[model samples]
Every structure is written in C-alpha cells, then in structure tokens.
Target: MSANHLEQLREAVVKMNVDEAEAIAKEAMSDGIAAMIMLKEAMIPAMEAVGELFGEGEYFLPEMLGAVDAYNKCFALLEPDLKQGEFEPKGTVMLGTVESDIHDIGKKILAALLQGNGFEVIDLGTNVPSETFVKKAEEHSPQVIGLSALLSTTMSEMKKVVELFEESGIRDRFRIIVGGAPVTQQFADSIGADGYGDEAQTGVELVSRFVAAP
Candidate 1:
C-alpha cells in the first residue's frame, strides 16, 4: 500500500499535476510515510524521469516547468518533516550567472532541477563576480560550481572563474561546469572547466555524476 501511494505521487509529479501532487504528498504524510522515503523513492525519481523526457524531446519547456512546479508543491509538503528528520542532501551545488551577465532564466531552471533532484543549491543570482564565486565557494565548499552566461561578451567571465579558482590553489576541490547560450564543450575545455552542460537537465546530470564519482 505504501508503494502504491508513492507510485501515485510519482505519477502525479511526472504528469505535471500540481494539485494532485500536493494532495498525494499530504496523504502520504498523514499515512505515516516518512518524508525522506517519499522523496528518495518517489519525488527524486519522478524529476529524473521528467529530465529524461525533456532530453528525449517528448517534453518541452512548459511541460518541464509544470513538472518542476508539481515537484516543488510536493517538496514544500515534505520539507518540514525532512528538516525534522535531519535529511542530508545528496550534495551541495553553487550556481550563478557570470559577471556582467544578467540572464538567469536558464540558471533558475537549473537551480530548481537541482533542488528537485535532492541537491542543496546556493544560488548566487545574476551578474555574480568571479571573486564572489570564489568567496562563496570557500564558505560553502559545494561539490559542484556551475557558471552560466547568456551573452557572448560575458562568456569570458567563466574563464575568469576557473582562473580564480586555479589562482586560489583550490581548483581541485570542486568540479566546475560551464553552460549558457554561448558555452560549448570546446570552450569549457579551453577555459579549464571540468564539464559542460548545454541545458539545465544536462547540468543536473553532470553534477550528479561529479558527486557520485569516487
């Protein structure tokens, strides 16, 4: 019965049914199903499936956004219990748009997806300077640092971030991934980024890989 309940919740999230997802989350809580179990077994997997659908071109931005909303609704219901349970995140990720670039729609989506996938995200917002990235990295020590830039002129700022980390001699401490409109695998390699993600889902998968790696 618990499995059935979790499965329904998963379906609701994956199908982008926000109200149904919230209702199922409430019911699951009332039924004494641990929030952590529901998150790990149902919600995370549902979001991952949503990512897969987006990658396969079966889901578009609107569908993916709806799925994220559903997941957020369910997560909101689970957060209190999760906090009380002392739920440790899968990992921590620091995200920001590069210095001088104010485009953050992609970054915001990436943050949401990362949160839904169980990573604790520290969003540094748009027009974040390289020094701020390094400073925050020292404070938070996230496993992954994601740099985003929507404009070609600001793409060079990602290189500055990598250079700053290298200059600080903490380059090896975190996996750095670069993305945005003008970012490419070649550019990432040239700028010494550990990985490149062309989209938000890809960015989440890259972070997951970095954290799961030995």
Candidate 2:
C-alpha cells in the first residue's frame, strides 16, 4: 500500500469518520501493517491533531468526543492484533478516582487512551482510598500512578495518596499524575505530583511522555 492509505486513515480519524477509520484500520492490517505501527504512525498523530484543534477553540466537546470515538473504533479493530507479552509495553499505569469521588467517565477515558497508546493500565475504579493506591503501587510497581477527582472536595484525597507514597519512601519508584474536572496544574504542583492532565487526551500525552522519559 502507498503512504496515501496511511494519510487517508489519519484523515478519517481527524474527521471523526468512525466507520471509515475502522475500515482503513482493518485494511491496513490486512496489508501487513503492524498494529503498533498503525498506532504510532496514524492514530496517535491523528489524536494529536485533534487535540490541537480542541486547544484552538476550533472544536467543542462534542467534536472532541467524536474524534476520540473515531479513534476508539480504529482501536477496537486493531486491538486483537496487538500481541501481548511478545513485546514490552510503553509503561504500566495505575489509575483510580479519589475516595468520595464517584465520577468515573474521566478516569475511564484516560485508561482506554493509555491502553491504546500501549501502556498496561490497571483501573482501580471510583472511590479509591489513598491506601489502595499505595497498596497497588507496591504490588504492581507501576511506572506511573494516575489520580482522578471530579469534585473539588475530593481533590485533597489525591494529595493524601501522593504524601502517603512519599512518607513510605517509595514515591521515587513511580511518577504521579493527576486529572479530572477539579484538577489543575497548580494544585498538582502543590501536592507534589509529577504531572497534571487538564483533559483526558492531554493526560494520555502526559503519561506517554513521562513513561518515555529517562
């Protein structure tokens, strides 16, 4: 296949053409394009472009969701083709919402995107205690721990988890990232988090960078 097919695939995702993206993904796989290559060459770049569009105010929430939906369609088509354990993952990420914060959509989105980007993700679900995060981190020894909180009231719960790791002297073992509607860069810095994602897509990007960093 020509490079045009890859460009067409990227355009399909940028345009939020779900069916077309899936069809192209399937066709690309059949043409012997590796699933990871498809992800790195087409899907990720497409999402990056979509993120830029969103940042420019050219895309609204619905439009951003549409692009992500399109990316998900392609991901579903390519998922089974991904060989597990045959190659190393980008990184492992542990995710959870803070205790008393029952919201999960944001966490779920970040988990899925992280998985698509080749990270092994463990989603601890909503209302997760600081101890649970620490326990899981100890057990998994993940490269990153992602905290989510949709309520301002529960934001402090994220800080508690960070401090718990620090106090345990295991904080350097993994990078800490925080997100959700109530999360901010300032808040994350104040709590000693290594990174903050203002939104789901950007959060994935941040995690990717952290994992790839030395």
TM-score of each: 0.62, 0.62
Residue lDDT tens for model 1, 1-214: 8999899999999999999989988988899998778977898789778878988999999998898889877876776665452247899999999988876656766776677678898999999999999999999999999999978999999989999999999999999999987789999999989999987789989999999992
Candidate 1 shows a clash count of 0
Top candidate, metric lDDT: 1
Q: Scored by Cα lDDT, where does model 2 land?
A: 0.84
lDDT for 129 in candidate 1 is: 94
For candidate 2, lDDT tens digit of each residue in 1-214? 7377789899999999988988888888888887767876787789778878988999888987898888877876776665344346788899999999887756766776677667888889999999999999999988888999978999999989999999999989999999987789999999999999987778888887888883
Each candidate structure's count of clashing pairs? 0, 0
* Model 1 ranges off by over 4 Å: 1-87
Candidate 2 lands at a TM-score of 0.62
Candidates in order have lDDT scores of 0.87, 0.84
